[model samples]
Every structure is written in C-alpha cells, then in structure tokens.
Target chain A: MNPNTAWLRKTVALVILIGVWEACADLGYFDPLYMPAPSKVAVALFQLFAQGTIWPHLIATFSAALGGLVVGLVVGTVLGAVAALTPLVGELLAPVMISLNAVPRVVLAPLFVIWFGIGVGSKVALAFILVAVLIFFTVFTGIRDVDRRLVERVITLGGGRGALLREVYGPSVIAWILGNLKVAVGFAFTGAVVGEFVAATKGLGYLLSFAQSSYNAALMLALVVLIMGFVLLLFGLTGLLERRLLRWRG
Target chain B: MLRVDSLALAYGATPVLEGASLEVPSGKFVSLVGPSGSGKSSLLRAVIGLQQPLAGVIETDIGAGDIGMLFQDDALLPWRTAEQNVALGLKLKGVAAGTAIASARQWITRLGLYGLSERFPRELSGGQRKRVALAQVLAREPQLILMDEPFASLDAIVRARVTQDLVRLVELRGISVLLVTHDLEEALALSDVVYLLSHGPRARISGRYEVNLPRPRDVIKARSHPDFAPLLQRLWNDLSREVGERAA
Candidate 1:
C-alpha cells in the first residue's frame, strides 16, 4: 500500500469516529456528563490552555518522563554491554534482571514515592526503573545476537576489541533501541503518570486525580488527549531519527 | 606466500582434519575441495586466526592485517551501506575518512556498483551483494586473500562472471589466494593447484593436482579446455570414493 494512501485512510477513519461520537452525544444517545462530545472536549482543552492552567502540569510530566528516559537508556545500555561482553556477569545477573522485570512496575511506584518523597524525584525514579529494564533487555539481546561472522570480518581486517565494539555491536544495539522507541516512549510516560497517581504535588496525573474528585469528565478527557498528543510527538521524533540514522536500510 | 604444515584441527575433543599440509606460492590461486563436513571452513578460520589449530604451523610472509577474507555467507554488515562496508577495513586501519571513502567509491565503481553504494546488504540481490563483498576485500589491498565459497550461493552465470572478474582483479594485483569450495568445477576452473580432502571424522588431503592452464582464464570456457575433462574425471574418481566410503 502506498504510504500516503495509508495515512489518508487512517485520517478518514478517525474523522468518521469523531463524527459518530459527536452525533451520538448531540442526539442524546449518551449523557454529555459521562460522554462529552469531541467539540466539548476540544473546548475544555482550549480553556485549560487559554487559562494556562495545564502548562505547569504538562511541564512537570514531560520533565520527569524525559529525564527518566535519558537516565535509563544510558545506564541500561552500559550495564547490558558489560553483561554481553562478560559471560560470567551475564549469567549471574540474567535471573535477577528477569525477576525485577517480572515485578509490576506500578506496584513499586508507592515505594519510590516513600523513598524519594512526593516531588519529581520519585516520579523520575519510577520512570527510570520502568524504562531501564526494558532497554537493558533490548541492548543485552542486541549485543549477544550480533553476527559472529561480522565480528570476525572486522577482526581479520585488523580491528581490535574496541573496534569490534564500535563497528559491530554499537550499530546493532542502536538499531534495536531505535526500533523499540515507540514502546519505550509509552512506557516512560506510563511510569511517570503512574508515579504521580500514587503520590505527587504536580503533574498531568495529579490533574487527572483533581478532575476525578470534581467529577469533571470533560477535563479528564481533555487531559487524556493532551497526554496522547505528547506521546505521539515523542514517537514521531524518534521515528524521524530512525529514518535518518537508518537511511542505508533503503 | 602461505604454507600450512602438518595441520591438525579439532572441534573441542572431536578431531576434524589431521596431517593436512598445503602451500600457495606467491601470486598463485590454490583451492581446497572437500565434502560438507571435511573441515574446509575450520582450516580457513585457523588461517585467519579466528580459530587455533590443535597442532600445526601456519607461515605467511604478509602481516595478519594484510590478509583479506571473503566469508561463505557474504557476511556484509546488514546495517551499513555497501560503501561503508567496503570502507570498514580502511577505517579500522586509521585511514583518513576522505581517503577511505575515495577508495571505497573506486572499488564500488570498478565492480559495476556505482549507484548502489548507498544500498544496504539486505536491499541488494545475491549477485549484487557478492560483488559488494568482493569489492570490500579488494579495497583492503591485502597481499593474500582467503575466500570460503564466496560465490557458492550465486547463480551459474553470475558465478562464472564473478569468478572471472575475481581472477582478473587478483592477478592484476599479484595477490595470493586460498579458496575453499565444494564445487569441483569451481576449484578446477579457478585455481593453479587444487587439493582434495577425504570426509571426516579424520579428513586429510587425499590428492592434489596442478592446473597448467594459462593466465586470464575464463571460468565459463575453462571447462571446455583440452585437459579439463581428464583432470576433472581423475579428481571426481577420488572424491566419489571418499563420498561412498563416508556414506557407508
């Protein structure tokens, strides 16, 4: 399928969905209090932005998520590389890492809040753990699965250990990480918001809690749409980077 | 230019080749032909220093860095462009970026891949990938080249063309070559000398023949040479017996 046509089809489907949703609300098929029309949600979104009420929460959430993502990506990649290069270390840590990953990250958000307090520190820490485990597995497998023949080719060409890491393993790991960026972004956001839901003074998650207490469905839906917008933006940015970096894949 | 004496190779406790010896004189093409499990790949790995022999001495006048290898699977890095793959050896050697790029581009052009330098290995056809791999090896300017069935997966016409081009390019550079292949015709057509090995569990060089063909030989037409039929027949007779014995 042509890419343009695929995009067009998706846009049409979304438009039709919104049209049906608005029609249902206008025709009183659903109560606006529970299922607000798209236009009402848009108005709520506009009011929040115009009053500048959402900016602080948006910034707080963005900072915690992005900060955690960077920290996790770096730490996980380094640890994974060390594990891959040294088999003994990998063997020792494999089970421990797997067990940690198996634990529900949401359950740990409360512990992080108690430890790091109710600031962005706890949120960032929670997001870090979630993103770290994910990226660690990715980097570890990527490094291990690097083609031995490719490494041999480099070695025979006079490449040493450093060269092998740079030429053979580095690009492979980067490709794997970039391939999973969309998922990583979603996980990072989930970690941040979930941390806020457990305990937080400011964030989109805190606003969600506030909207729930007031029984404001429009505000809740608006915040949800805004969060989705940010996630999509980050996902799109990563996709652009993937295309630029992996142009040779063409 | 290269010599292996009394080489004994094993995979852990299991022996593969024993009492194997061979030589490739300067600027000559030598081939080792054997069945699937006869340890031809193990020998190549040993020579390239990726594997160590149980007991043997491999002597070469050139430095390890001056040897280029073409793997049986092409082994081109899937993430790198053809030009980048070709330029990798030079880059590893600390060549200036401009020099490496220039050299790689020249090889790409020479191998009829002028517009394909930016394409990754996965985007290329089998024949095109082989050509790119060949260009990579040639660009390394190695004094000796070790090829492990570099043309194995290519179609007949492409194989013949690639073989002919490889011979012409290597001969022009006066580079010694040691090729391992299962195809008797490929071995006979391309080499100055061919060694036949018995099948495992203790594969050895069962026979060796010197091809007295002239230089700049066409691999396609070499089969029709006057001496080609008899030489092939004799080697086939020896090889067939080994195959039969292994089957038994």
Candidate 2:
C-alpha cells in the first residue's frame, strides 16, 4: 500500500471510532462521570492549556525526561564500551546487566522518591536507570556483533585495539544506538511519569493524581492525550535524526 | 616470498587441514583449489595468522602490515563511501586525512570506478563494490595478497571483467597473491602455479600443476589456450575423485 494512503486510512479509522464513542455518550449508554464524552475531554484539554495551568507541569516533565535521557545515554555508552573492550570488566559486568534487564525496573520509583525526595530529582533518577540499562545492552551487543570479516580487514591493515574501536566498532555502535533511540526516549518518559505518579509536587503525573482523587475522568483523559501527543512528536523527531545519521545504510 | 610447511589446522578436535603446504614466490600468483569441506579457507586463515595452526610453520618475509586480503564477500564498510572505504587502510596506517583521501580517489579511478567515490557500498552494484574492495586492498600497496574465492559471488561476465582487472593491477604492482577457490577454470586462468588439496578428514596437497600460459593474461582468452583445456580436465578429474570418495 502507498504510505500516504495508509496514513489516511488510519486517520479515518480513528475518526470513525471517536465518532462512535461520541454518539454512545450522547445516547446515555454510559455514565458521564466514568466515561466522559470526547467533547467534554476536548473542552478540558483546551481549558487546561488556555488557562496556562499546564505550562509548569509540561516543563517539569520535559526537563526531567530530557535530562535523564542525556545523562543515561552518555554514561551507559561509556560504561558499556568499557565492558565490551575489556574481557575482565565484561565478565564482571555481564550478570549484573542481564539481571537488571530481566526485571521491571520501574518498581524502584518509590525508592528513588525516598532518596531524591518527591521532586524532579526522583523523576530524573528513575528515568536515568530506565534508559541506562537499555542503552548499555545496546552498546554491548553492538560491539560484540561487529562483523568478524570487517575486524580482520582492519587488523590486516595494521589496526591495533584503538584503531579497531575507532574504525570498525565505533560507527557500528552509533548505528545500533540510533536504531534503539526511540525506545530509550520512551523509557525515559516512562520513568519520569511513573516516578511522578508515585510521588511529585508538580508534573503531569501530579495532575493525574489530582484527577484520580477528585474522580475527574475528563481531566485524566486530557492529560493522557497530551502526554501521548508529546511522545509521538519526539518519536517523529528521533526518526528524522536516525535517517540523517544513517544515510549510508540506504 | 611466502611459504607454509607441514601446516596442521583444526577446529577443536575436528581436524581441517593436516600436513598442508604451499608457496607463493614474490611477484607470482598461486592458486589453491579443492573440493568443498577440504579446508581450503582454513589454510588461508592459518597463513594469515587469523587461525592458529595445530602444528607446522609459515614463513614470510612480508612485514606485519604488508599483507592484504580479499574475501568472497566484498566486506566493504556499508557506512563509508567508496572513497572513504578505500582510504581506511591508509588512515589506519597514520596517513593524514587529506593525503589518504586524495590517494583513495586515485585508486578508485584507477580501478575504473570513476565518479563513484561518493557512493556507499549499498548504492553500488556487486561488480562496482568488488572493484572498490580491490581498490581498498591495493591502495595500501601490500607486498602479498590472499584471496578466498573473491569473485565467486559475481556473475560470469562480471567475474571475467573483474579477474581481468585484478590480473592487470596485481601484475602491474608486482604484488604476490595466494588465491583459494574451488573453480578449476579460474585457477587455471589466473595462477602461475596451482595446488589441488585433497578431501579432508585430514586434507593435504594432493597434486600440483604449472601453468605455462603467458603473462599480461586475459582471463577469458587464457581459457581458450590449447593447454588450458587439458590442465582443467586433469584438475577436474582429481577434484571429482575427492568428492566421490567423500560420498562413498
């Protein structure tokens, strides 16, 4: 199928589904308090932005997620590279990384809140842990899976360990990192929001807590939609970055 | 000159090559042909020090950096342009970026890849990629080159053209080659000397032939030489016997 047509079809399907939901709500088949109509959610979304009440929450969430993402990317890459290049380090680090990867690490959000307090620090800490483990695995496997023939070619050309790292493994690792970047971004946001959901003074998750306490279903849906929209926008941007960086792969 | 004497190679307890021996004199091209699973590639790997030998000796006057290799796969870095890929050896050897790139451009053109310097490996055809790989190996000016069925992936026409270019380039530069292939005709056409390896539980050199064919050789025309047919027939018969014994 043509990509544009596929996109158009998806849009039409969503619109039809929303139209059905609105019709059902108008017909009173559901409780308005529990299943707020799409129109009511839209009003709630518009009011949240227009009243300027959501700006601080938006900024808080964005900064924490982005800060954790940057630090995690850099630290994870350095540590993973150190492990991959040194056998002793790799053997020591492997089991720890494997176990970390196997667990649902978000449960540590409460501990992060206790250590960093119920603020941006806690959210950033959670985001960092979530992203770091993911990127560490990406870099470790990327270096290990480098084509053996390419390594041989570099060695035959008089490349030592340093050259092999710079020439053969470096670019390949970057490609792998970029390929996994979207997932990492998603994890970063997840960490931030979930940390806030557990404990926070100000964030989208704080607003979610308020909505839950007041049983305001319309406000809850509005916040959820706003977060989804922002994440999708970031996904599109990262995709552009991937295409630019990996033009050679085409 | 490169020489391997009584080389024995194995992967764990599975012996690949035993008592294998060969030679490639300076400025001469040599070929090693064998049935599949006869450890032809293992011998090449052992000579290059990529694989450790179980026992035996490889003696070479070539410096550690003075050897180049071409594989059946092009092995070009997919992320680098043709020119950059060619320049990789020079860059790794500590050539300044400007000089390395200029020299790479020259080799790219020399290999009939004009105007393709900016193309990545994925953007090039199989034949074009092979030419770039050849340039990559030759740009370093290695004293000896080892090839493992380097042209086996090309179509017959592309193979003929590439072999012609290879012969011309290697001969012009006086670089010795030790090529491993199962193609009897390619071995007969390209080599000054050919060694046939026996089928393995423990494979070793089973037969040898001297190609008296003249130099400045054309790959296609060399095959039509009156002597070409007989040498190919003898090599084929020997190889077929190895395959037949494996079946038995």
Candidate 1 lDDT over residue span A1-250, tens digit each: 7886998999999999999999999999989889999999999999999999889999999999998999989988888888888999999878878998998877898899889999999999988888888888999999999888888888888899998888889988999898887787898899899888788889999998888889899999999999999999988899999999977665
What RMSD does model 1 have? Answer: 1.8
Tens-place lDDT digits, model 2, residues A2-50: 8869989999999999999999999998799999899999999999999
Which runs of model 1 end up more than 4 angstroms from their true locations? A1-3
Question: Model 1 over residues B177-216: C-alpha lDDT tens digits?
Answer: 9999999988999999999989987789999999988788
Pairs in clash, predicted candidate 1:
none
The TM-score that candidate 1 achieves is: 0.95
lDDT of 1 at B25: 93
DockQ of candidate 1, scored on C-alphas against the true complex (2 decimals): 0.73
Top candidate on TM-score is 2
How good is the docking of model 1, by CAPRI class? medium
